[model samples]
Target: MAQTSSHVDSEDTVEYWLFPNISEDGDQLQELEAFRTRCFTFIQDQSQNYIWHEDSINLKVVTKRTAGDNPPHLYGKTRYGCNVEDEWFIVHLFRSFSVTENDVVIRIVDSDGDFLLVEAADILPRWANPESCINRVFIHVGQVHMISIADRPSSITPLPSGQPSLMDAVHIVRSMPHLTIAPSPIQEPIRQRIEKCVSQIDSSLHRCNVFVPASVAALLQSYPTLVAPAVHAFCQRDASQLQVIRAMRFFPPETRVWTSVTFTKCLYAMLVHRNYQPDHRTGWTLPPNGDPKRTGSELGMKLAVGFELLANEESLHQQGGDYSLEMDSRWNRFLNTLKEKGFFQDFLESSQPYNELLEKAREFYMNSVGVEGPAKKPVILRLMQSVFADIEKFKKEEAHLPADDDDSWLSVDPATLDQILGDKFGLLGVDDDEAKAEILPKLETFLHRKSDYEGLTPSSGRKKSRKLSHLAPPSASRKTSTLSNTSDVSQLSNHIGFDPDSFASAMQGILDFALPEDNWDLESNSSCLSSYSEEEEGGELVDKEMNNYMQTMDQELLSTDVLRTSVDNPTRKESVMSEGCESFSDVENFQPVKIDSAALESLLASYTMQRGGPGPASILLNQLNLPRSQISASKKQTD
Candidate 1:
């Protein structure tokens, strides 16, 4: 079997050994050659892709390849770059083949120069220092392990030459695969399942609701491979998932807590440093791309790189509470380490990303404590309740004290009471004497009624003691008293004497005066018109008879001369009787008077001017009421 010797100065040193499964009975050495050939072929095909999957075994591998001085070596038909392949080939070997924890191959990887080792220079084992651990990093079951030189199995046969044999060292490492720690048998499956889960996560945090299902939780309990990726995904989705994850329990409760804490701390540290080291000691590096749109595979590779650190880290196995104080202590310790290494020179502690990490950590710690910690009763809420409780207690005490009496006005200082009453009653400033005069009586009356109602009759002595100088006694002669002395209207009506004849004549004159009558119901006039219409086909006889009757009336009116009569004329009664007989004689002769049409129109116009719009009866009645001179002038013009 070919093996690479420990070389601190070499950049392309890599070696692999197959450790037989304790459960599987087989000759591992015989299969080692065949396995190497297959691996070489696989690398030849996979060297171009940094990450590739083998669907047959449900396995995935993320790697980094380099082309060094060695040229392509032909394998079958295709050429392979086996010379420059790193220990990551061993990572693929175990994972892609589904190698069990108890039995698997181990690849020794050494960067001989790793910045992580430099930063961790203080805590690294002396044997794992740059010089000694150059080719000692053993990759078993997809985890990086270190086997110290002191722990290496010694060769049974002594070498002939005094110089150490490189072949002997290779044989010792190949024979002692079991010497390094093997991961839990269940961890392989969990890693696959978690990797699959992480692969499905979308890079976008929008509407991303991550729920830690019971199945995932169970897998997480066995192997916390899910922690880093979950945190990365949920960082912008739901921070409460951090608390949910923290509450999960392993056999040692601190395992779950510390795993989450370490993963988060490492992630934050990398982000703050702005660099992601895949395997710092191996000199493999993946700088942060700042591409928030990174695919799940890219994220998984980043996660796997940091996940191995937890398994190798011995101090994280210690017990610790999830209390914020403890969490802050652990976080500060990490920061102090970084500070010592000169990492966070001008970092803003209160920036969003750092604060978000702290908030999540605080939540995890609080959730882990559940009901036992100070978080059960937040200090701010407790303080607020205490303050409100004190206020309520004070109010209850005040309620129990004796209350002031409603009738305790007598105890009040007179001047102060007077001022308060003046302000209360709106009597403090009075400018109008009339308003004051009107208000003083009402105020005095109100005070008198109040004293009576309260059954507290003020004695003359108390009244004399309390001088209300702002008020004046009510006036004795009130304007309202005059109402009682008003004279009776019954006797006054008797003194108003009335002359019966004069009253009758005045009523008669009013009755005789012309007034417009409304004929709203035209049914009577319609009946008369209809009767006249039935008497003749065209109602010609009706019209002729009505015209003759109107002419007879007009002649009688002219003969009477009453329209032109003067109040001084003594022959007014004789002239009326003679005119009546003459008017009848004139009607028998049936002679039509040739009256002036102009004069008649003038008369009608004068009548309309005096009496607005009225019927024939109303016009005749109004004509009689006109003055003697106007009636005479109209009649003379008509004649």
Candidate 2:
């Protein structure tokens, strides 16, 4: 078995496998050779002779869980790992990265233990999540495979010896990738510990014989990790570190146990939010904590883990599987209470607008009176924003990336890859690839296209991808010349030919002569060029001529290329308008009337009144009990 897949710690990283096919690269092959050191050359088992040749290293693995059994296909032997053998290649450690049911996380720790994270893609080769645990694999004589060395008698714990370098082992295992399945079946003691926590909340969550809101039901399917991190270690709960994405709990954050009152409130919220079918009846038992008016990722915080397990052995009873999470009497009795309120797929995304909220609320108000369960697929709110917020809050971010979406089973481990892929009744979200596949049958119909609104945004529409894309990386330094000094100000001097007093007097005289004292006598420099006479034709003719000339100049300014460009630029247009009076510039500065208020109200009232069924006007009249307002204090004073 390989040692832990190493990650740089400043920023914690998840475990994942990289490069499934290792034969093509010569460098990769050489790197693989660097880690191999022959330990056992040959060994013999009952059926056949087992050979561990000089070049090939014996791969080792430990069972993910002692009780959980792997499917026959992934096992290295029929009963090879039932007993321990001296020749071991992989060793299982206490702490290894855990994988979702997919047996894969997109991240991979190569055989070298060099953490390799890849750009996520919708590709043929499926990506696994960051792995924390290396699974037990099948081993045989003269084999190039690995086997599980778990489920050995409790009395034996091997005195592990003669190990390769930890990193070297890691490189070898990852390079030749071992069979990684989920841990062995839940052992008896741990199963007992987990089953003890079962309550109405957990039972309802497990979808045993009771019903829950889509919100609560969805939580049940995913709460096991946080709820029961350890079935056997309740006394040492504080010692174990549990991190779940957006782990919510029952309201009043302090309430760990689920009560009937809490349950009612959760249902009320679904009703208010309109997460029910069109014909269901919403009961009147709404808890203040589950108010529908509330919105955001923190909508239901109390429903998180630290709760009980709702493990129904029936879901775990696979035909060829020997798995069961044992439950006690108290747990079974607690589940009976949930029979009345069935699960419904009425949860709407928090991002929806006011109108959608009203619509959903209308649908959810119906009671579950005769319904079995939610007829439609579960509605999962995409609360990625909330999930990432908590991740950043805890501070493991080396870069900005969304954490993996967790849809693992809440109680019965997770469904196999095939079961998960073929699922049609799951919730909708980034993690619900199977559900998304079912929903999005018209693939090309949803291909993203540029919104017309963006083009009409009246802002610069430069392609941001040009800057962000790797194809046209920005240059370190642009080639351009810098400005040099045109002249030296230190070398320049001022000269005056006359005394200060004389020069001042001369300048005053010049101003007096240059500026006319009379009101309309050659008012502008244009008067000198036009030679307009104020004495003839009442001076109105001169004013008209001046106005006409100014109008023509204004038109010329508007026609200029510079002014046209300024008009095209919103910033330039605003700046020019703010400076002073501009021709038609005030239009841009015009403030719109808040609404077409009076006229709009009148039209709506009239239309509603005419259409019947308490028209918009009648509704207003009904609110006030008067057709119109009368200004009078006489009645008020009498009262």
Candidate 3:
């Protein structure tokens, strides 16, 4: 038989030896014994391939702690100086393979006299060949002794190197369970039910005063949505029941008790839910700022409506019948009276009278037209005169009228007066053709100045131009001229071609003559035409005839004055000659001065008595004092 190595050895070698003579009392000897015992126990428990030799007595010990065992005791001395017997275990078969400084071998003998041989390779497992037995043992034993034998590697293999692919990571991720994200689901049917109820409530609220069941449902649904179910659940009641309870809170105690109804509570709850804050307590004070009495807009609108009614003649007539026009006329006059008396505090205060007058004006409407006609013109005029007379009497008594204060709401506007007059009377003043011709021009001029006295211009591009042509001829041209200027004596004299005193006297006489006589009659009856005369039927007949002649003469004079004094007065035709004066053919020696002087003196004397003047002498003296050149100067100045 060929002799072969009893223990197989290779270039990768492992050694097995025993550490036998450990001193128990030595610092390191105890550690050695523990380590040796642990290794022996591990090797014995391992598979039979790593079994300890049972017959070994002298064991080969190899260690780097010392070159060989020291003191040569049978075993190492104990740390406490106790003697310990050393037992030797021999190697049954020994073989030495290549060894390196990094390789370690551990050998142990237990109390049973069994040998434990452990060979560990020092090379890293990452660099070891899996097929080599030494590397296989090394990989199993591990550089870290704490590693469990169960986890030890049977073999080691080198990892091939290159750029790592991401596919492995992607596959790993894909294999994981998916995590989904989605929006929370809505209870759409519940929302629809709430919306439908709300819509019904809104519709019912617009038409009916009472809240219906649908409204209650809507309110209940909204409450659930707004307040969490956890909070609402505290009541532990159904929505309908809760709504009924809420309605009770809103209803007044009295209403609920008296009417046996709870609608008020429902209304209150709805208002509360909608965030409406109403005065809930009995007798709660209203907001001071919201007081209707203090609101100017409300007062203004009321006054505007009142005036509009007052100004509408047709409306007035409809309301007041045949008397409506006259009633409206009276209403306007009343407003004017109030305005004149300073009852109005400002232009705005005019509305007070306007509002008050509306009640009186209603008689003018068609609804009232069946009523008796108002006493016509003359009666109306007389009534106005009486009213004014009373006012004058009050003034004479020196009684204090109510004065305007800041809070007083009396006011008047010229425009308002114009509207009132235009609506009712068609216009103010006389309607006769000649009287109108005389008054219209003066009135137009007066109105124009009144309308634009402040002279504010329109800011817009389309500005209106003043139409001054309506002014009287003299006023339209005179320097510093006005209607007041028409009263200047010298100017009148120059314009009329008479002495200033004479012209003034003539004007006074004309005005006095124009007044209607108290006793004059519109009827042809002689008794009606004149007061009873004592001369007729004795003194009565003659006196009556004389009175009638005087009355007739007065009427003729008044009619002439009315024609002559007017601006539209027709010119009288002049005779070619007069009984006392020369014909036009004898114009050169006419001697007009003496005649004119005599005529002027007579006229002045008569006018002085009629007009309550100082005397005829005073009139003459005033005329004489006027400078001859002063008249010409005044004319030039006026021009």
Candidate 4:
């Protein structure tokens, strides 16, 4: 017997050799069972009793199973089982190990004729008894081992310990109330493009580049919702950002119109937060009707119109209120000081014209005081009185001069007169007719003769005396002389005890003195006589006459209360000038000579001499000594 080849790819081959007793002699089955029991018992006892035997015996059983059927079975039957049972077992085992449909298990062959049972009883039920029926299949002879058993995974590879599984993560996101489903990862490139655009816009806005428009527009094209907030942020950082948005808006959808209002509001907010107070000086001045731009388009002119309305309302309120006069006065004073410091020119350029503001001020005053009669009277009176007092004080101080008897005269130099006239009255250069007509008479009056005798020159010889006679001109001489005598008497009365007899005697002596002779040829000359006479007699007489006249004028001027009243009320000067013709004696007395030939010549001579030359004075003096006819002819020729 070629030892039945046990390594066959069939379960029948191995099963038939292992247990033959089941089908053999019935009585002998007990002994066979006992032998099998003893074999198992021996292996169990050896495992319990000897540590080394445990491992060796385990190997023994495996060795026995691997060895072909002959030795193992022969030894078991002869030593432990009956002969009859052995023979019968072989045949019956072969029959009992027959392959059946239900028991069809896959068989795998080994090189050593050993087999591994891979059946329903040896593995988990899920694998052995799969819901789907499986037919056993055989594998050909080779060393074989089980690879993967078909089994149900414990909970589908239980979720990771701490982190959410893929499904869990998805489910959690789905369940969230606020979470929005993000665009798919497939759209990542698009999102990246949008992000890049936004970044560019942000960078451009920071750098204050105009490229912000293109960048912002591209971003909004992809993500429209981003427009408003982006604009807001941009504007918050830079007030001028709105300009970019406005430009972009011009492209499409008319975003500019919407942004215009928002931009204006934004500007207003920024200004208000900064406590921006516009200078009233810079307030827009409307043309008489309205600004052309404002008149054309309501929308275009909204800001201008609104500002105007606001300004008007404010003006009305201020006018209607009881404003602080003191505060206004202080502000005016401050403005004046600023003007004095040269800031007024800048202010005028930068601010409103002063005249407009002044008109506004007057309007405000009137409104505050009410429209009723006499409501503004007191303020006007006070203002006028203050001005009058200032004028009077200035006139008194400015008119003050050396007493008439003083040797030095306040004669104005011709150059100084020329400069003053040129600057004040816009005269330039000289015109002979104008000089003689407009200037000479004024000069003569202002120079008023130093002494009466000084007028008696040989050249002016009898003509001057004739003019003196005309002083109390022929028509008025009698009345003038009587008035003059009375005036002298009155003046004498004020200074000395009134003894009519002595006063008469003094007048007689004055009358008796011979008129001084015109002696231009004398050694001292007429000029010398004039000088001495003026010093002794003319000065004393002029001083006395002036004092007396001033006193009498004061008495008469005060008697009517005209001077006091006029001094108290300055508007009277214009009224009196218009209606009454009071001689301007005060003005005439204050007026200085239009030209002082001597003084001018002296100045020019000094200037010339200092520059190493003879002066204009010497030249003029020489010219002056020439005959009057020659002088007149020369003047006519020049003219």
Q: Name the candidate that leads on lDDT.
A: 1
Report the alpha-carbon TM-score of model 1 versus the true structure: 0.19
For model 2, how does the per-residue alpha-carbon lDDT over 85-142 read when each residue is reduced to its tens digit?
1012111110111121112112223332322112111110111223322331111111
Please provide, for model 1 over 1-639, each residue's C-alpha lDDT reduced to its tens digit, 9 standing for 90 to 100: 222344323444332333322222454323432343344334333332221111011111111111122111111111111222223333354445434333343443333442223322222332344455543444454543434333112322221112223333323334554433322322333345435433433221111111122223233333232354333332332333332223222111211111111222233333233333232333222325674323222333333332332221211333333334455554454344444543333547764333333333333233222324234212221111222123233334434433221223225585676456445433333334433233232223323333345343322111221233223222111211221111121123334455343465466557645431222112222323444565576685665555455445645765754434322334333333342124233333322222233434455456434433356522442322222223333333444
Q: Which candidate do you rate higher for lDDT, 1 or 2? A: 1
Q: Estimated TM-score per prediction?
A: 0.19, 0.17, 0.11, 0.15
TM-score-superior candidate, 3 or 4: 4
Q: What lDDT is reached at residue 210 by model 1?
A: 16
Candidate 4's residue-wise lDDT over 132-190, tens digit each?
Answer: 11111121111111111212222122212233322233232223311212112212332
Single out the weakest 10-residue window by summed lDDT for candidate 3.
Answer: 77-86
Those runs of model 4 whose alpha carbons end farther than 4 Å from true positions after fitting are: 1-465, 468-638
lDDT of 3 by residue, 1-639 (tens): 011112323321222332233444665533443343333223222211211111111112223254332221112100101111111111211101102111222222222111111111111121222222121111011111101011113212121122112222112112221110000111122233334433443222211121112212222222211111111122233434433333333222221100001111222222223321222442122235676322322221222221222223233344565443444663455345444544333535324333322322231121112222222111211112222123233233333322212321124476665455445423333223433232233222222332357332221111111232222222222212221121222132234333433455466556665432321222223443234443356666665666457556645645654324423322121211121112233433322111122333343345333332356533432222222122222222323
Give me the runs in candidate 2 sitting further than 4 Å from their true place.
Answer: 1-224, 227-285, 288-310, 313-475, 478-639
How high is the CA lDDT of each candidate model? 0.32, 0.24, 0.26, 0.28
Answer with 1 or 4, whichever has the higher TM-score. 1
